[model samples]
Target: MDHLETWEQKGYVQFPGFLSETETNDLKEWVEQISSWPPDPEKWMHHFEQIGPIARPARTEYIIDFHDGLRRLLTTGKVPETAGSLLGQPVVLYKEKINYKYPGGGGYAAHQDAPAYEFVKLHITCSIAIHDATPENGCLYFAPELHREGLIHLNDQGCIEESKAKSLNWEPIPMKAGDALFFSSYAPHYSPSNQTDQSRRTLYLTYNALAEGDLRESYYADKRQAFADAEKTGDQRMRVSKIGHFNGKPPEQS
Candidate 1:
């Protein structure tokens, strides 16, 4: 209730300790397992970044089908329940991904997620912190109450124009492990490079109203094609996301 009120006024809400310490540890171990799995192009997807002379893991997605623990965590419990509550209807999974921001990993530019997530007009994304996230570790920064403005100054790269992004009043959201931050698809958000020696990981689970129809499979199918197209065109952007908002070195560039 209070969080819902905050969501209306700020376009985002934070739920501290959404996951208990034991649950957080389990999720972390599962993430470690997922991250360690060698790239299986047929199943889960992995993206890499060139940090220094070494290629490091940057992201992993499409894991719910592979890991039962994560599947249940994302699908059955409080996560989806809260998402449905926020959306004011039953919700269906749209997509899920874990951002592994290892030391020196890159951050995203200011952008609204709606442009990249197709087939749904509205969405709610919950960012569950897998590790302590702080301003020094590239935690996300957001512009309060901006989601109601719809898309703002979107550019060719699927991000807000840098000048426009800079002019917005932005605030950092530092969260402890197990904390969850929920925001609208239209929320204007960004982050900087991780300046710490440790990894700053976050699990992002996105959902749409059940009435919108299930678009998860279609979304990933299109994303794969989009990435393939970019590869064919020699697009030298980060391969981490479908959108150009990501600010990382593409695998080829590494």
Candidate 2:
């Protein structure tokens, strides 16, 4: 079976070493560059959280306005095309982020991406491994076949409830530095906290069908405003379920 079939059946397809080492290295360099880029509240939003007793930073909702390398990587570099093929339609960019889960960073609770992202009709995210992912360093764990049921039972925090998640068989997916994992928005998945000293960074690019009309600008605009609103009202919790996993402390260190 081809990738399209695999995606349709398994909810995702893991393309290990899909990117060359050189390409992966290039992306790492971009991660460094973007990390250093002043986190201006107006342009992009980043999060700094406490991991155990240490504070670590990660960037999300970063705009691709002036970043030539990332622009090429997302558009001309075949990410959108690959996602389009898997989706059985031509797709457009929806959202992008570099999840640099630093050491001691907390793990995400079991959840599906669809319910959290309701603005769009369809969503598919491509996770490109910027560093080797292992169970020890918080690699992704996916629940196969649950995506077919659509969105599952959600908890107060918007994550899949433990009662519901317990019924599904979970599997840890490990990838090399240059691999990519493409999963549907409804796919049930989560990750553990990074135990190793090294950080677990992944570049995630989400896309929607071409017919959906480009909503990238609108999406980010809404997020920026919502974030400001959250701050003003002190709804300071990570409203987005994706990053909400990085809450207070990483499970009380000994």
Candidate 3:
């Protein structure tokens, strides 16, 4: 089946070598530049986690807001083309982030992203592998043909119920550095901890149909408020988002 057919049938699709080798190399360099930036309140937001004995950067959000290379990459390219095609309409970016799953970093629990994402009824995420993602290094695993069911078995933590999640047979998605995986927000998915010594970094760009209105700025505003409210309540969870799916601990000094 073609990619559209695959997306229609399974609510997801993978495009091998979606980014050319040269493009991928360039992206890797851009990621390095972003990674080296120190924590600054006025710029891109960074989050850290306790990975083994070290406090390593776990995630970076709103990257395209500050990085010209990534902004151009998403705003004008095959990335938006594929996203618009899959969404069945012209699309606008809803949000974006880089998940840096360093060795022993963390894993997200089984969950449907639709619950966490708001301001749009339809959304799809494109995950571009910046480094090879292997099962040994925390590749994503997705439950096939389940997006049609809408949200299901969600827990208080905004994730799939533990027992229910464990019951579904998840298919592993191993990707080479430049591969891209696109999945609906309703798809149930999870990833395991990176056991390998190397890091597994993936850039996730989420988009909604342009007809739904451009809600990127509003989405980020809501997220910032949600996190701040959580902090005020003394919710010291080491989660990357308002959702409690992350399985990592906060750095001791946070």
Candidate 4:
């Protein structure tokens, strides 16, 4: 099936065997080894322990490589060609991350990724499974046709109560290692808790139009601080964005 049409109909499409078995195993081993090593062995006896057996740190190197690899894949004019057919323009990868959910790890609250961007429609998110994702292992779940309705606001509890209250049916996507899941980021979706013994590992990469102006500088600064905090020894201090690209204020505090 064509990729974008599948996504438009089902809210997501799974490409099985997207990566080779050897490559999958190699990436899995790399993640496992990295997750086992302590960030600062001298200061913390077992900082890796905090990561749990199910999750790993999102290292800058890994993220950069992942982004570059995906960019190359999209630039091949195959997948992006299809994407352009859907979006009506060439697409650019804007964000990428590794998402690892450990056993008993809490689920992500249902939300849309479109709100984070500005003046855009029909963006895409491609999530590659690094491990077998079963219902017990917290596979992704989503409601089809939700994206067409537009973004809904979440309440204080971070729950979309109105959508939940509606007769919304969620379809669980069970995917194997090497399968790539593609979906519209505007769709309301979330992964359930990892009830099994093993962790759910995935590489999530997002693509959108390259818009003019710097709107997410503050968000990126927050991300930079998050990265910095992960390297620090003591209780990490949360950093606020002093830059003003987000809300029409100056770069410096008034």
Best by lDDT: 1
Candidate 2 or 1, higher lDDT:
1
Better of 1 and 4 by TM-score: 1
> What are the lDDT figures for the candidates, one per model?
0.92, 0.80, 0.90, 0.57
lDDT rank order? 1, 3, 2, 4
TM-score, structure 3 vs. true: 0.98
lDDT of model 1, residue 192: 96
For model 3, what is the C-alpha lDDT against the true structure? 0.90
The list of candidate 4 runs beyond 4 A from truth reads: 33-62, 65-86, 117-122, 157-159, 162-166, 211-219, 225-254
TM-score to true structure, per model: 0.97, 0.92, 0.98, 0.67
lDDT of 3 at 48: 87
lDDT (tens digit, per residue) of candidate 4 on 1-254: 68667777776777788768976786677556545555452221111112334232322112333234444654455455544555556666555555566666545556666665444454777777888998887888877777777766655433455556255687888899978877776677767667887878886666665443222333444455554675484422211111111111111212
Which TM-score value belongs to model 4? 0.67
- Report the Cα lDDT for residue 91, model 1: 95
Off-target runs (Cα >4 Å) in candidate 3 are none
Q: Which of the predicted structures, 3 or 4, would earn the higher TM-score when compared with the native?
A: 3
Model 2 scores a C-alpha lDDT of 0.80
